[model samples]
Target: MKSEQGDPIPLWERSEPAVRPAPSPLSRDNIVRSAIALADSEGLSAVSLRKVASSLDAGAMRLYRYLSTKDELLDLMADAVYGEIVSEGPIVGEWRDTLRTIANRIRSACREHPWFIELLGGRPHMGPNALAMLEASFAALNDSPGFDTVDASMQAIRTVNAYVIGAVQAENSDLKNSMSKADWQKVWWPYLERLIATGNFPMLAKIIRDASHPSPDIIFDTGLETVLDGLGSQISR
Candidate 1:
């Protein structure tokens, strides 16, 4: 297969016209999409070339037409999920607001897809869209009125990216399922209260006493606001 640069690296391994004697029958796009759907439904670990081929009603060897290996297909799938994110540029017209928009977009995309979380942690993105997304974000901060240099832009963008990724991690723990508020309290609170009542962990006890609920939404928004506030000073300076 050739890269976007037209450099021929390798081709399919199988033989025969029915298998991969000619060229790829499944386009890279089709392979990526199928992989994503399988991963989304059955989890990333459930994804295999054989599984995808079965889903497409094609021979297992047919996938070699497009992807050189399962690794290539996995990389393409990661990029495919990233491509779903739609950035708004900037809504509030401030550098911090622009950061927020980028953060929200990243969070929305990653958090919504369980497979993406696992994929990104290991794969280095070579996809055009993924590269474009990163470069575009850097440009937004660099071109903003307050942003002056690479250091400033990097710092601000890093903070925004960190919070977004943190939120995605938070979402993943709840990925399998979620419990209702009453159920959560009924199960977890009693244990927490018992620990707090013991006065063993002072900081823990203080926090538990002051906070009435374990709200993931509140944690995300509060962290988001604080991150924005910190970056605002750095950007404005």
Candidate 2:
């Protein structure tokens, strides 16, 4: 019943809080949705139970009646974003294609909510929506002969998830540092050229002289294709 912090287990793992009928207009879903909106616009640091309650025109005590802590609210926010990854209909295609679609969707989601990678870094999210995403991924590979056991399928899923998360984090960092291809060439190219002139790194000098700078999108697609290709080879073997 106790968490590592010596407090009671979080709200997500606990039974729902009791509410009097027709007592308040706020619901857990409303609170979570409002929190997600705040996060989407202002970033995750801006999200707090007080701010969420204020946005909903409710009291912080009202939110506590549902979600016990800000961590639980973050769990809910992460799961809500996962809910957006649902397919309108059944995913149709080979396992590779299905996985590719899912991976790209994850990357897009991360781009949309730059804070998602940070929220997801600490622990596994097993909320309903998060579980549903895992279920869908398992379903995609269920019929694949390469994944004969649950372990194989799960390994493949983890590999794809790891790649997607890392790729998005790198992309987000580049954006934060203003190091896009154009930005890099604009701001750092002069210093880079001088470094190249020193001839300390011949390969880097050659790259600077001959190679075009890659945009984040280009880097992401190239890395994704490489990962998918490696996964395909494993499945075939």
Candidate 3:
């Protein structure tokens, strides 16, 4: 098969080996699962072909038969997680509701696997599960009044995806450095108060004084609704 930029065709696009596996209990799924588990427990940096093989009680060379390089293995691992998003079934109800469901589900998955944000946009995700997600999303927008053409529909999907990725990244950042509300007041608020007291940034001071400190969940939902509102306007027009 032809290579792209000197790299072999992605694992998803490559044809499977013609020969069947010899008598062995190991499979590609097993290897991917083991790798995912390792990442979940010890972070993404901990995952290696040798470590995955060790978890499966198999030799590292056996894994090379399925995945030739660490990059290929990482692609497979990403696709495996995308499978979870696909299992949620197709989008339902109005276009807005469909997008909301998708965004929320992706957020949940990212939270569950903190390493997911690091892997986002790292490679093309053309595996079966990832393709299934794209197909389902396109189907949802196929009848939307605002999206009369394939390109328009895809653009709408892209808009929502961009928002979801950014929102999740922000939320994940807070989660990584999370502290209890009381703890934050004691430890960080003093420094923040000192900064606010300086007359240099009045608008920032007003916001801190006037705005309620909403939880991350509230912030995510509010931003998502605003995005849908903008999309709804186009649909209505």
Number of colliding residue pairs in each model: 1, 0, 0
What does candidate 2's lDDT look like per residue over 1-237, in tens digits? 567789877455776566555545777888988988898898899999999989977778888778777888889888888888764445547778877878888888888788888876579887888888888888888887687888988888888888888888888887777755686688988998888889798999888679986888888888888988998898777
* Tens digit per residue, CA lDDT, model 1, 33-146: 887889878888999999998877777887775666888777777667656763434334567677777777776676667777766545457676677677877777766776
User: Worst 10-residue stretch by lDDT in candidate 2?
Assistant: 15-24
**Model 3 per-residue lDDT at 56:** 79
lDDT of 3 by residue, 1-237 (tens): 358667657677676554445544676778888898998888889999999988977789877777789987887888888899888777887788888988888888888787777787556577888888889888987886677889977777888888988988888788778899899889988888888878887898888789997988898899989988988887778
Order the candidates by TM-score, highest first — what do you get? 3, 2, 1
lDDT of 2: 0.81
TM-score of 3: 0.86
TM-scores of all predicted structures:
0.78, 0.85, 0.86
Residues forming the 10-long window of minimal summed lDDT in candidate 3 = 15-24
Residue 148's lDDT within candidate 3 is 83
Q: How big is the positional error of residue 44 in model 2, measured in Å on the Cα after superposition?
A: 0.7
- Once fitted onto the true fold, the runs of candidate 2 whose alpha carbons sit more than 4 angstroms away are 1-24, 179-186
